[model samples]
Target: MQGVPEEWTEEDGGTGERSRGTGTGKGEETMMMELTRLVQKTVKESSWWERRGIDCSILAAAFISLPPAFLLLGSSHFLWFSAGVLLMGVAHGIITIKGTHLASHGALSESQAWAKFWAVFFIEICGSFSALAGVKGHIKMHHAHTNVIGLGDSSVWKVPFLSRSIYLFIAPLAVPVITPLVALGRKYFPVERDNRTVAMVTLGLYSQYWLLINVSGFTSPLSALLCMLVCRAMFSVPYIHVNIFQHIGLPMFSPTRRPKRIYQMTHGVLNLPRNPLLDWMFGHSLINCHVEHHLFPFLSDNMCLKVKPVVSKYLTEKQLPYQEDGYLSRLQLFFNRYQELMVFAPPITELVGVQ
Candidate 1:
């Protein structure tokens, strides 16, 4: 109730009575239009550093970490091996989460050819997911229907049969393994067949296996496989949790009765406070500036962070919602209320009357 609108109540099915004083009238619409213009202007005026310079640096760092990681993993010493595996996992997470995310959104490049190339390289080669599927699922569906029930609501992550403990702690360890299998399954199952998705998914998985055996000096296939599993699961818990924490449990909307873009994004999306590791690994767009990213999906992570203050202030001054919650608090919320948040269909936030 702390963050809920004054008129909202569960008894009313989240459709609070319309009040002209609550800033959901024509004045609110005008303000939202102005806010959009302001954000667009901010994006256009963003410096090269905000556009792609920082992303390039992050990508470079992720790539640079790899050789050393392989070297360390290949070492005969146990401590050396452990350290190398840790570095390898961190590098992989950064590349997949940050690099792939940006590339998927076409935020990393202005050139169409380069964007496609990066998408293949980051999502397929590094992330071990199909670039085509990633785009179709994330960009086309998720972004277009954020918080809309049964579509972009991140409901796929929910597993009702599993206990909360296992869902939270154990199940996520399988994501790296499950990701490729799902991609391969998609290829055969054929919603829309693309030879490239299967090809790249296979190539990516095989490449990593080859690297583990050759460059990482694993003596046996079993050893190499073990190393792969361990490294991939390093950040798996938070990797899965972050996806759900930011979107699920927030106000959901009926697809047919969704609010205006500004209201939907502002009310439904929650931003976690920035963490140094998460910021670097997941990118600002996924971590701290999620609301801004949802509002303008094309902006780079650096640009999202740059525009956060302006976005937050504008929403605040206009008395619109600007949701921000701490990471640990969200985690606890999910852990404590997993059944309500993860297992059930969240009640629709009825904004039709208000809007």
Candidate 2:
């Protein structure tokens, strides 16, 4: 209720009639339309062929590369085996984060049925997270209401008991292990028409386990499990880190004083410098093109990158805040202000006089 928009409220007149024009509704509309045009121009430049190719290639790499890496475990060469496992883990992370993210937004396919199929396959099956839940929680809640406390604040990862070092550095390692358990645990809560999805995801995870232990001819079950965990850890750490860094330290607002679309996105989203490691796995949208991604959530990673200059320049010319900070700086900020920013709720500043 605190985060509800002011425009939705009506002032009670003497006759008990409601007034609807209290907020900067017209100004917000204008800003939204201007940003929408920029997004449309970017969309016109995007090619479906390129998007499909990138999606297919990433999916293929995730599925195709891992089997050979698992086979390498039988070699018993420590260095070679470790290298293979690392590669497998990075690839799996890409599938889980990038692939699942795209599918969750329905960006991977033109057809609704095909999009649903892919979202279920990549998110629930490969990523070991529920697709339906992700769309409702992530796309609908997080994206729609970024930096709004109790909605898009991303406080789920906050562990008050753990010190900054442990919470930031060590706890993330458990994300790969924790994710599937959380997914299964969600079944106890009410979700509509989700029984089949839960079953499929459970079966899919079991199928992967069976592949490693029985079919892949790993030295032992332990080896198979180790391989899976290693790969998932490669993804889980940065996945948690990026999620926090992108929006946590920036401006937050109550629903009544929430900024217009462009202002909210630019003010709230902070882009990290491009890192080769993260860029390749998480894709551009998760990396330096984050502001662009927040502006156009449906855009492919490549498209997000392509439109960066235009969006950044427009915001800069307009004298709006377009935040960019180095990855290390953000980590340090979080470390220094962990209590203020992470453990407790971030303070909300009511945006005033923005048209």
Top lDDT: which candidate number?
1
Task: Summarize candidate 2's per-residue lDDT along 1-355 as a digit string, tens digits.
Answer: 1211222122311001111223446655665567668867866767775655676676677778877866764466888777777767877888888888877766677666677778888888887887777777776667777787777777777788899989898999998788888787776344654675678678877776787776456857777787778767876767888999999988887755576666777888889998987887888888899888877776677777778888888788777888999988988999999998888778896667773
- Model 1 residue runs over 4 Å out of place are 1-29, 187-193
lDDT of 1 at 328: 89
Per-model clash counts, in order, read 0, 1
> In model 2, which regions exceed 4 Å deviation?
1-24, 188-192
- lDDT (Cα, tens digit) per residue for candidate 1, span 1-355: 1212222122311212221223456755676668778887886787888778998899899899898998899888989988998899999888888988888877777776677788888888778887777876786567777888888899878889999999999999999889888877675334544567777777877887898888887789987888888888898899888899989988898877777667777888889999999998889999899999887777789989988999999999977788889988998999999999988778888865556
> Candidate 2's error at 341, in angstroms?
0.9
- Taking all chains together, each candidate's TM-score versus the true structure is 0.89, 0.88
Clashes in model 2: which pairs? 89-231
